[model samples]
Target: MSADEKGDFISNNHQVQPIQNSLLPIQHNPNDALPSSSNPRRNPRNMQGLLKFLLETTKNEDGTHDSEFSPMDEERKEFLMNVFESMSVNIAEKLTESLKVISQAVNITQQDDPSDCENALEVLTDLVDEVDVANDFMKIGGLQACKPCLYSPHNGIRWRAAQLVGECAQNNPLFQHNAVQLTFLDDLIKLVDTDTDERVRVKALYAISTIMRGNEKAINFFHDIDACHTLMRALQSDSDRLKIKVAFLLSTAFSGDQFLKIQLQKMGFITLLVQLIMEALEGKKITSLEHLLGALISLSKDLPDALEDCRQPNLNFLNILDNIIQTYKDDSACLETVSYASSIKQMVYSYTDVINADR
Candidate 1:
């Protein structure tokens, strides 16, 4: 056909009517000739080709692509969603197997060349983050599927695994209760204090934080195992990122009880925290300063007495508060410090009223 004729056929003069008619169920004539394979009852290859074309057109190198009217993509997404919706033992077992395969791939890649190890770790990390995969894995045994990866030679894999474990430990109480092995906590503590990889250390700190918050028994175990000191040592690390995470974890611990806050205060954590906050403010690292401000707020709420004690004859608490209020008067973060100062002022006023009343 000529180009113009082809265009006309495609646009308006096509034989779509015949095709639609053929798609309708046919009533076979009893006395007619039998159908031949040339015109087979149904052509599987055509259907397969159509499906392949739809899939390829709607997918990119990275993954599935968004489409406006792609039925195949929609069906595939729905199928995967349904598979994830069914939470059963069988599904958990299958996810465990998938994680094992990814773990093996990570190890093999790390051994072949350290350079490619990061790609493998990224793949493993993505796999662990799959909601069905993570949910099922946690159901089967939290951290069990990922436990082997913790010892992988590549720190990236170990770090990602620690983060996944932390997420699981935080959200699933059963996993938290069942998975409290001394070796696990000790390994996490070691990573927090001594891991050469900064990301690994951060992940380890988060995992420790999750464990601390998951169960009261875990908290007691951490203190009994002397993990708190390890966490404290992390605060002294040169990395500000590490310091921030350490501060956050310690803050959570403080919010749990007065005794924990007092314990941290006794360990001289407040001094380090105040210094960190001051340094962040002076350096004009606004994000770090904001985090430090939050930590300070928590400390102030939990250990007001300890903050009060920081006020010496030469360095008064009220004077420091006044300085901070003036320095950050326009900043939204300064509001936290302002609120704290206002609370302190109200308390003092109340005490003075009581004293006057007694007089």
Candidate 2:
């Protein structure tokens, strides 16, 4: 009876234990704290966890601490460094290749809902933040692919196209050199001067400013076209964004090209700016006062002949300048505006023509 009972109980217990084990939830291994296996996100700068894992694997128990870490451990460290660096280079290349593929996929023809084109442009817009990626994008005919999109009936496509151009051109001399060519520059100016969509106008102006800012060849390109006239059209556009962007470009984008500055002056930019500043002073809606003030200061410095335009009593430029300083002297948010306004007044005061002028 004892043998039969014991044998039957043992066999049944084994079977029941197997089923229970299968039904139980698996335990989590704390050692699996690494980021991922399918898409690893290891930080090269902060790889203490990986180093610790490698340390554990490479440790020699031959003499504990004495032989725990040897020359082989240093070699392993160098190998790990090389692996991470190679991985970084590979990731960058793959990312650039993905951008290239996506850029070529943006079809320029009319799409009922060009959201695919828009989404792809958005991806290109973000990825071009890296200089090498941007250079790679420009090298892979990304701009040529994007050119027709600038004329897409869809506003999103148009604006995103211009924005991607700007992203590629921003602080990128290589892209600017490629972008400042005649066809591209003409297209950008057309958008800035005539695009019905304000978003397109703003981004086109952004692209233009980025391309034309620091490049002497770009400035010469501007002179060849009616680029100054294009900018003047921007000043008059109903788009406040265009006005602000124009003002910003005026302040910082002339690249000390005296001819362009004098061209802007002769085109009555001083009078136009005076009108804008007066409107701002009168509380008529206008762009950033700081930017407007900065543009005027830049003009006065760059175009000496502009001082007479600023002094035109018909416009009452001195009165407007005083009003600006008084209005903004105490305004914390308008420190830049006040500084620029005061600079203009100080510059005028230093002139022999206005030395006797009333405060």
Candidate 3:
């Protein structure tokens, strides 16, 4: 009786213990932090989250140090320098990852929903304005990705792309060179040539101005492609800004090679410029007038065959000067006017010597 009872009781206890273990709920810790893979706070799991975090850090109220995104703030440089340094090691990879997200959001085909495009472009603009990031931006296909946006049916996207592309080419030689190689220059020429939007045209022209600075090869390329003609036509527009930019572009091209100056003169650029100067003086748009004056002075300073060109019987630069003088005879007290007068007089006197010598 004792042996049978003991065996039965031991087997029943073992079976009961197994059932109890299977029935109990799995033990877990409520306070344990989740893995970064599962937690958005530990790591941003999506583009919106990352963008929000970045935007928050750029605000002064974020309590980090200072705002980095405010263009007018003094702390922007320090903040940008710090971020630039931190990302310097793998900036291209890091930026590429972020831009991939931004690209989708800012795609031109995003229909009428532009909230993402606006925010992303603002971020990109701030980043590129931080100095050397523009080169890195190009390295990461940022410019290529946005190229189509330049012609977005929506003006906002086109304008944003225009601004971003201009900044991408800002004072960055490599970026500018890349632009030329990648046919961005051709795109820019098209924008300036036929885009109906004046704002976009001006921005593209500004980018062309930046890209062509001290770049003789690019200037020559533009000249070879007949882009000079497009620029010259742009000068005919009534928008003073566009005219100033076109004049500036001509001045830059003239500054590049002597042949460019001769070519421009042959194309009647000098005649058109003189007419523009007279119009500027009459319109009283002081800034436009000054820029036009600067362009003429820039051309005069750089044109290798200035005296030779002035000697052309058909040019009549002295007559043009006389017309300007007759137009501004009473403006003796205006320093700018007087300065222009003196400059034109010097040109006439110099050209007169050349003419007399030819005789």
Clashes of each: 0, 0, 0
lDDT of 2 at 196: 87
Ten residues in sequence with the least summed lDDT for candidate 1: 16-25
Colliding residue pairs in candidate 1: none
What would the per-residue lDDT of candidate 3 be over residues 72-145, giving only the tens digit for each residue? 46654564455334333343443555466456643456456765665666566666764466755664567667
Query: Cα lDDT of model 2 overall?
Result: 0.70
The list of candidate 3 runs beyond 4 A from truth reads 1-98, 105-107, 302-341, 351-359
How far off is residue 234 in model 3, in Å? 0.2
Full candidate order by TM-score, most accurate first: 2, 3, 1
- Summed over model 1, clashes come to 0
Residue runs of model 1 more than 4 Å from their true location after superposition? 1-94, 102-110, 113-135, 139-142, 300-305, 314-317, 333-359
Flag the better candidate by lDDT, 1 or 3.
Answer: 3
* All candidates in order of lDDT, best leading: 2, 3, 1
| Local distance difference test scores for all models | 0.57, 0.70, 0.63
Each prediction's TM-score against the native? 0.61, 0.70, 0.63
Q: Answer with 2 or 3, whichever has the higher TM-score.
A: 2
Better of 1 and 3 by TM-score: 3
Worst 10 contiguous positions by lDDT, candidate 3: 16-25
Instruction: Output the worst ten-in-a-row residue range by lDDT, candidate 2.
Output: 16-25
